[model samples]
Target: MSRAAVPRMLLRGWAIQVKDSSSFGFFIMSSLIEPVIFAAIAAYMFRAGNRPDALLYAAIGAGMLGVWIVTLIGSGQALTFLRHAGILELLIVAPVPFVLVLAPITLAAATVGMYSLAATLVWGWLLFDVPLGVEHPWLLLASVPATVIGLGMLGMLMASVFVLFRHANALTNMLGYPVWLASGFLVPVSLLPDWVRPVSWLLPTTWGAEAIRTSMIGGHPLPAIGACLGLAIGYFALAALTVRHFERLARQRASLALA
Candidate 1:
């Protein structure tokens, strides 16, 4: 994995995904415009007078949610789609690794997500006077990549389920919604019911949001960055196990089908 080869792999992945115009159109609608619209409504409804910090919180929250959408929607759905289309088999036969084959789809989604984040931030600043300067610049940038890797891994895990199951799309959708709600996408975790609070603690998005919030807004410290990092690593590990299990099952099923 030379640095130069990375871009080529990603480019190959990107070229394959854009072959479908419908997917590209849906990507724009779901990944770009929808997030900005939601953020605008949130900024309007939660407008504050002197609480600049709160606005920053809102912006970061909204932005991070956009990023999550890319991983959750794009990676998960693309995997299922490819499998059903029989392209997954072709990709498996390619020279690139499985992860590389998935990279362009995720990256394409991430690009849209970033655009949505930028739109939300601009809208927040212009319409609601939300401050956009980073209080902890390094922490803010570091959290972006970490959060992406963490969520991307989880998406891959969910995508793997599609290999062995007929209704993994529904399962992915079910898993995605609870994470968005419980992880404080539109509301703070503190506002959730007492019993739900504990469940929220178990979600990776909760730690991700906390890390991003702490980084962007100059407020209370998170439990520990290391703890958040550990949680993310654990998530990746679990997803990897799930992927391996499903891959083995897929191979067995294919052999049986041939026989």
Candidate 2:
């Protein structure tokens, strides 16, 4: 596609993805917000590990987890579903870059995360008595989008890798809980084994969650936000390289349409 066409492709692609995702009932309800309702209730009922002080943490963490799971499944499944529908070949053969085509879907998936975050917080307060207190309200607000941006870019790298695997859903299943726990979104990272901390630092979830938790707990969140955005840029660079490599490998092996 020409340079001017790229802008149009991105805008139209993003709009189409937003509309398509909005219409998916399962995506809106089951994957995005339903579990969060139950999680908030469960956490409150359990007193968030018998510490009422932790309930707010649990609520926000649950919101972040919703974002993580949805982005993971949606972005990873984008190419696989296209392959199943026989559009993968067309996207790959087109002059437009594959990342441009896939970016919007992954981003739209991340955008759903923002919705889940807002909905989780609102319902948690109204239904479960979860505290909405924030020591740094502005920082907390900023962290939500930073978290989404970081995760969405990370999703691109994930999608690139998933392009080579037929069972990407299995990978999403494998990653969800482990990442949640290690990232300290719902649980404090200190509770995990000492070795897990370093690995956690490398993952965007850790930074994103930290940005959020710090904002709530009255710590400096700017560094955390900066780290998340920095990683977003890094993930995009890595994703472009990996997409090129994996697309070539799949095309060479004739597995692009294997579904």
Candidate 3:
């Protein structure tokens, strides 16, 4: 790839995502608003006596949920739509890496997902009077990009896996909320079944939420940050290998063309 290729591909992906207002509206509603609403409900229902801290926790968890939604739902459905429209086949033949194409779409979705973070923070503070104080605001800020990178990699990995399926959207819906549940967003990892903790440890959502909370509540964020970056790299590598394998399979079997 040329030095400029990656940036160009990223811009192309961003532009495509932002081009249609109708589609963007759907992204906003599904990824941003819905997650915040879910969080508010969770906070209300689970509020150990209407405590601000508990509500704040739920708010942050909701923001993290947005991260998952934008990446998983966004990439899963985008790839499925591309396949339906016969664009996936064209991209497979394109000189740029197919993962590169998938990446920016995920990035764009994550960009939009920022609204969730902001909305949760503001909504919690304004509506519930949850204080917005962070013990280490800088760490909280830093976690944003780390979360995006980790989520983006996970999304790319999922896109690679999902590209092979015609019912990718349904598969995405099946996987999205379950991942959030296991992510320890609303529930503590300690309270989850022992079997689920190990799996949660491997997910970026687990680390992302941990990083955010630790930063907000005044704990060292290195552990959570390390987990997120490390797992992101692992997922990215797996995605590279898996995407190549699937591309070859698509080419040989012509499964990508059937849809």
What are the TM-scores, per candidate, against the unseen true structure? Answer: 0.77, 0.89, 0.89
Task: Give the C-alpha miss distance for residue 49 in model 3, angstroms.
Answer: 4.0
Q: How far out, in Å, is residue 86 in model 1? A: 3.4
Query: Candidate 3 lDDT, tens digit per residue, 135-180?
Result: 8888888887788778878877888888777778788778867888
Stretches of candidate 1 exceeding 4 Å from the true structure: 1-23, 48-53, 94-112, 220-225, 255-259
Candidate 2: tens digits of C-alpha lDDT, residues 1-259: 5788887887788778878877888678845566577566657666745776666676777877787888888787888867787888999988888888888778778877666667777877887687777889898889877887788889899998886776888998899889888888777889999999988877777888789878987788999999999999999999989988978888789887786
Write the candidate numbers in order of decreasing lDDT.
2, 3, 1
Model 2 C-alpha RMSD to native: 2.3
lDDT of each: 0.64, 0.80, 0.79
Candidate 1 TM-score over all chains jointly: 0.77
User: Residue 127 CA error for candidate 1 (Å)?
Assistant: 1.9
**What is the Å distance of residue 123 in model 2 from its true position?**
1.8
Candidate 2, run of 10 with poorest lDDT: 30-39
**Whose lDDT is higher: candidate 2's or candidate 3's?**
2
Model 1: lowest-lDDT 10 consecutive positions: 219-228
Residue-level lDDT for 256 in candidate 2: 79
